[model samples]
Structure formats: structure tokens, C-alpha cells
Target: MKKYTLLLVLFFALTNAFAQVKTQYFDENWKPVIQEDMVYYRPEPKAVNGKYLFKDYYKSGKLQFEGFSLSKTEEKFDGEVKYFAENGKISGTSEFRNGVLDGSVKTYFEDGRLRQDATVKNGEEESAVLYTYKGTDINGSLSLYDLMTFFDHDERVKQIIYDGDPKGIRQESYLSEGKAKYYGPDGKLLGELIFDLYGNPNNGTMIEFDFNPMKVSATRVFVDGKEQQLEKI
Candidate 1:
């Protein structure tokens, strides 16, 4: 009688275990499960308080991509996103916030060099500075310089320097009609002239001299004709 009771108890326990395993094989509708919604499916849904949460990976498991989903929202939230090289280095990492790129995005070359990095805001490119082995500008021209600045929208303002020194610069003043009138080098009036529409000299006067010899050597003023002014050095 003891042997028969023990066999009966073992049979009932095995049957109960089998029944529980079978129960885990069905969907919420009690249908045979072949797809993801089934309880026995691999990579099972991680839940908290009956709410679907994010996915986590074990150290032994290979995770190519991973992210999260907040409750009642379809957007994925903060996560550590990584891509691996075929030879086993980190190829890139793209950060995200609420399903939009809201931080820095970095990418590396195959040789483990930092190839590119950029800042993104809400999926829009805010400001990006790129580095490359061979890069070109808007005109499709390459340069050997390390840095270049461009002004594509505004008229370029040029200043003329005298004696190849910026400190000895010249000022170009315009008259009431937007015409260049007096030009001074290093705060001293060098010459005064008027220009036509084509920048040709009209009626004007110019005082020319030599400085190193310390002499008011020559003065030619053109009002209607060239007039020489005599002065002491």
C-alpha cells in the first residue's frame, strides 16, 4: 500500500507540471501560440505591474540593439545604443531621448579613429562640425588647410593695409552720395578724390610726398589742372 501511494503521488505531480507547461504555451485567447504575443515565446516581454517595459540583456547574451518604451507612449526613451565592428571595436553610439536624437552622436572609423561627431536636437541637425581624411566645401573643392571660414550670404568687407602692417591701416570715407571722398593712412590724410559711377577719378586733389627722406617733396592737386604746392620740409 505504501508503494502504490507513492506512485500515485508522483504521477499526479508529473501531470500537474505538464499541465502548467501546456498552459504557458497558449496566448491570452487560449489559442496555440506561434508568434510573439505567446507566453512561451523566446525573448519574452519584460513587464512591470502588468505594463510592458524595456528589454535588458545578460552578459552572456549578444545584444546588437536595445532601447525602451514608456507607458502609454510609443516613443523609446533613454538607452545606451551601440554598434560593434566586425573585428570587435565600438563603431558608433547614438544617444536618444523620447525617440528623438537630443544629444551627441559619434562614429568611428574601421581603424579606430574618431571620424565624426555632431550635436542633434529633437531629430534636427542644430550645428555640425565634421572632420575627414579628404573633405570638400560647397563648391566641391578640397583644401589642405586645417580650418576654413566662409561667408556665403554677406558682401565681403575689405580693408587696405599700408607697408604690409595692419596697424598702419587706411580708412575709406564716403560722401553724402555714398561716394568715397577722403582716404587716410594711419590717421593722416593721404589723398582726397571723388569718383564717378565706374570709380574713375573726377575733379579732385591729391597730395603726394616722401616720408623716409622727411621732405614735402611733391604736391600735385587736380582741381581743373595739376597745381603744385610749395612747402618747407
Candidate 2:
């Protein structure tokens, strides 16, 4: 009977020691802060034990960001996240599922003005609403589909999509000289663009054109932004 009791005590002792070790490791990666009588935790690419509220701070001890992370298999951010500017103003907010962006996102300007509002799904943008710094509606509610057709002739305008103007679409496409040429998300031919010598949209200098899906037909000759309409060959 005494031997059994001794073994039980030994088991508890080891368990407590193991728990302390884990706490030490976790504390090493996460910095603890207390602001306005509220405790916040910050992480820096380290391991944890379970669900924890993560936070970041600015040099002046202001809360910079906050979110939740699960420490299983890997420290994956999960749930709604928020970011703050140095001046204690909300900068951005988004939802995350296991580290993948997956929900509505909103951002604000430094002067506490709404800057961007968008929806994300599976780490890709679905729709977005843009606004100017002075709260002007620059681009109305735009979906990835809408941007794919916004500027068919103006590459400079289409380049806004690549720069995350409203909704960011990770299509198999790229921008060249202000022109965005690529396929749609459904693997279909979206459209193409033509640029002049000065990388402007003009029919005078026709370098290349997309005739079919993923097929480029090369046939044209015009030079130096000169105004000369070429005969269709």
C-alpha cells in the first residue's frame, strides 16, 4: 500500500514539472504586457500548448495587433484578428481560419477613416469596396468578376487590380507595362491588351494580341508612338 502511494506522488511530481517546462518555453516566445489593467500576450514564431490570445505592441506600449492562435501541430492563427495604428486607432480587421484569411476584412486610414472593406475566402479575395481618404466612394462594390472586366482597353486601369485596388484575384495572370493579360479563375480566356511604344493603349502600335485561350498570335508592325493606323493583315 505504501509503495502504491509513493508511485502516485511521483507521477504527480513529474506532471507538475513537465507543465512548468512548457510554461517556461511558451513564455520565452510570448511577451506579456499589461495596459489599462488588461493583460495581452505576444508571440514570435514559437510553440504553445493550447488556444492563446496573441497580441502585438508598438514602441510606446500601445496595442498594435491582437488575435487568437491554436498551438497544435503548429501555431495557427484562428478566429477574428484586429490591427491598431500607433495612435491607438483601428487599422485593419479580418477573420482567419487556421491561419488562412476567410471572412470580411476592413481597414481604416490613420485619421480614423474607412479605407477598404473586402471579403476573403480560402485566402483569396472575393469582393471589395474602396473609398478615398476623404470618404469618397472611389470604386463601388466590386467583385473579382467585376474587376476582370473593368478595363479591357486600359491596362493602366486594370493594373489597379494587381495592386489590390479593391478585390485581389489570384488569377493565373500578370501585369506588363500597365497591361494585365491572363486567364480567368475558371481557366477560360478572360481577355488581353495592346500597348503602344510609350506603353499606352493605342491601335497605332500593335505588338501582340490574344487570339484564343492561352494562345498569342503575333502579327503587327508600328514604331515610336507615331500615329499610323496599320492595315488589318
Candidate 3:
């Protein structure tokens, strides 16, 4: 019985030495506080000037979260918050200043690949981004099916399809330009054949024009291709 009592006392001593404080803070009147038994008290001030900080830990003693606060206000200034994998590699980081999130936040996958990046301004989500399929660039050409922008509920700013490509065959549209347009074998506009102000085709605009009388020809006109002002002669 004496030996059992000594072992119980030793167990309590070791437990007391290791049971970290889960939460700590100050009272409304700026008094030093400590919490045990799910209750708080104005304990004798230990450490520096009434500034309260709290730390939580994993069962293994690895820090889970920590932050600071002033006594009289309801604001918390998180210096740095980190999450870790079970194997101890850092999995995430979030930084705050004066209670505002103002730094980069990153999260990593279990294999340590960057999973997400988010930007926070004043604790609001300014931008949250994700990445996928590392080491590859997006391929394929732009087409009319893709929306260029949105104007309103009914009016959509879409890519005007001419011969299927967004750039069109002659690469010309309602916008004003200083060049003549060109057409391809299928009578579809290809791109703008740039001409100097003196009406000479620039090298970039040089294209082969097949002079076949049997091929159907179209005229260039203003007002959404409605009124034919000029015809192919």
C-alpha cells in the first residue's frame, strides 16, 4: 500500500509537469487569468506585461495552433498558424497581423505537392486558387463556343464565329482596322491582309488568291453584311 501511494504521487507529478495549458487569456479588467477544471481565474501574473497568448498542442506535444490577444479588446493577432501531417511535415500555413489575414496561405497534399493557394484581405477571401496536372500547359485553339465575356443577362459578349475559329478566316470583324481582309478556298474569311495606307498589301497579309471563275464570290459591305456596296469583279 505504501509503494502504491508513492507510485500514484509520482504519476501525478509527471502528469502535472506535462499537461500543457489548452487555453489562456485575461479577464475583462485586464487581469492575468488561468483556466483549469473548465473555469478561469485571475492567477498571479507570470511572463510579460498582461499580454495574453494561447497555445494548443497535438497529443504528441507538436503545436497545433497558437495566437495572441490584448486584454480589453475582442481581437486576436495570430502571428503564424501551421498545420502538420502526422509524419510531422508542415501541411499548411496561415499568417495574420493585428487580427487581419495579410499574408500568403498555402496548403500541401500528403505527397507534399502544393494543393491550393489563397489570398486573404482583412479576413475575407479575396482570391482562392487551385492547380491541377502539374508540368503541362493548356492546349487547343480558342473557338466560338467559349465565352469571351459577359455583358448582362441577355446580351453576351461572345466570340463571333467566322469559319469556326475565333480569329475567323479573314481574322476581321466589326472592329476598324487599316488592312484589307482575305478569304480562303472555302470562301470563308481567313485573316486580315494588312495593306499600307497607300493601299499596298503588307508582307504579313500576303496570301494566294485563286482566280477561278467557277468559284462563288461574295461582296464586302457595311451594316452587318446586309447591304452589298461592292462586289468581286
- The lDDT for every candidate, in the order shown, is 0.47, 0.53, 0.48
Question: Residue 88 in model 3: shift from native, Å?
Answer: 0.8
Question: What tens-digit string does per-residue lDDT give for candidate 1 at 103-207?
Answer: 877788787766566667788755543444323253677532222111112322222222223234232334333233333344566566565666545546544
CA lDDT, candidate 1, residue 120: 71
Candidate 1 vs candidate 3: the lDDT winner is 3
lDDT tens readout by residue for model 2, 1-233: 99999999999999988654222111223443343333333434344455766666654568878777785324477888899987888999999998889998889878786767777889887767555422234467323222222222223233232223233222222344444343433444444445555666543333333321223344343344344544443
Off by over 4 Å in 1: 1-63, 69-75, 134-233
Model 1: lDDT of residue 233 = 34
Superposition TM-score, candidate 3 onto the true structure = 0.35
> Which ten-residue region of model 3 has the weakest summed lDDT?
144-153
What lDDT is reached at residue 115 by model 3?
Answer: 62
Candidate maximizing lDDT: 2
Model 1, residue 194: distance off in Å is 26
Clashes (candidate 2): 0
